[model samples]
Target: MPEATPPPAAGLPELPVTWRASRTRAVLLPVAVLLVAVFCVLARAMPHNWHTNDRVALVVTGLLFAAGLLMLARPRATAGSEGVTVVNFVRTRRLDWAEIVRVNLRQGDPWAVLDLADGTTLAVVGIQPAAGRTQAVAAARALRDLVDAHATARHRR
Candidate 1:
């Protein structure tokens, strides 16, 4: 009887392997503080004369700022031999390497994206742009390179 080849080791990396944003406090904290300031200013200026719609807008803006701040406060993404992990406020998703098809870094947008085999896209929002444009570009390229190398290495067997 002929011997069968063993499956390729589920080659993946270790955890605590984080891809974090560059300027967490600078980008998010300032915006959050600005939002609060705006809210206070609006409240002081309009006191009781503000319409319901205006009040709603202020509340919604405040919530958005708060959410942004929270996300920035703890920005991190990890990938291992098992899967890719993302952490955001009240939400987390893990995806196996096989699910990822390609990665792309678009200009103007704040982050890179992982194009999945299922026609879905996962945003790598954890990578902040403060590392500067050059670094951001390099990071995006590195991500795409890693995905390609991993996938190619797996299929070669």
Candidate 2:
């Protein structure tokens, strides 16, 4: 298994780092564009006798499908010195480094999951294996390091 590169000298990574599922975006974006094009072509090909509303509805349904695909590609995470922001499909949440107890990306898992101090696990879609296992492992390691660094600092105070 690939390991993440070591953290910086300060025992913490650089602030304001962002992670995204590049593969997901690469796949979904083009599909979305293609869907729109197909819808336009289909709309124009509809029979002249068909109701305008029916044609419009067909186009609208295609648009909605494209939108849904875009949403699936929307997951990302940004980590700063203060906290991390997680943006999933429909919800966004922020958490301090101390709030994360562990960062796990086990084999066969779809994405990284954060074991929180509150005993809940939060899925981090941004660091998914869909992007590549090496990338996912590196991200999970880096995040774990950040959480550890923060926890250590907090205990000293």
Best by TM-score: 2
lDDT of each: 0.67, 0.85
lDDT by residue (tens digit), candidate 2, 29-146 = 9999899889978988998998889888888988999999999999998988677899999999999776888888999999999888999999999999978888888888887877
Residue runs of model 2 more than 4 Å from their true location after superposition: 1-12
Q: For candidate 1, give the lDDT of residue 141.
A: 64
True-structure lDDT of candidate 2? 0.85
Q: Estimate each model's TM-score.
A: 0.59, 0.89
**Clashing pairs for predicted structure model 2, backbone only:** none
Q: Lowest-scoring 10 consecutive residues by lDDT in candidate 1? A: 1-10
Best by lDDT: 2
**What is the TM-score (0 to 1) of candidate 1?**
0.59
Candidate 1 lDDT tens digits, 1-157: 3222223334322332567675665677778877877875775577687887887788677878777786666655676656568765456788776788987776777777789999998777765465466766666665555566567766875
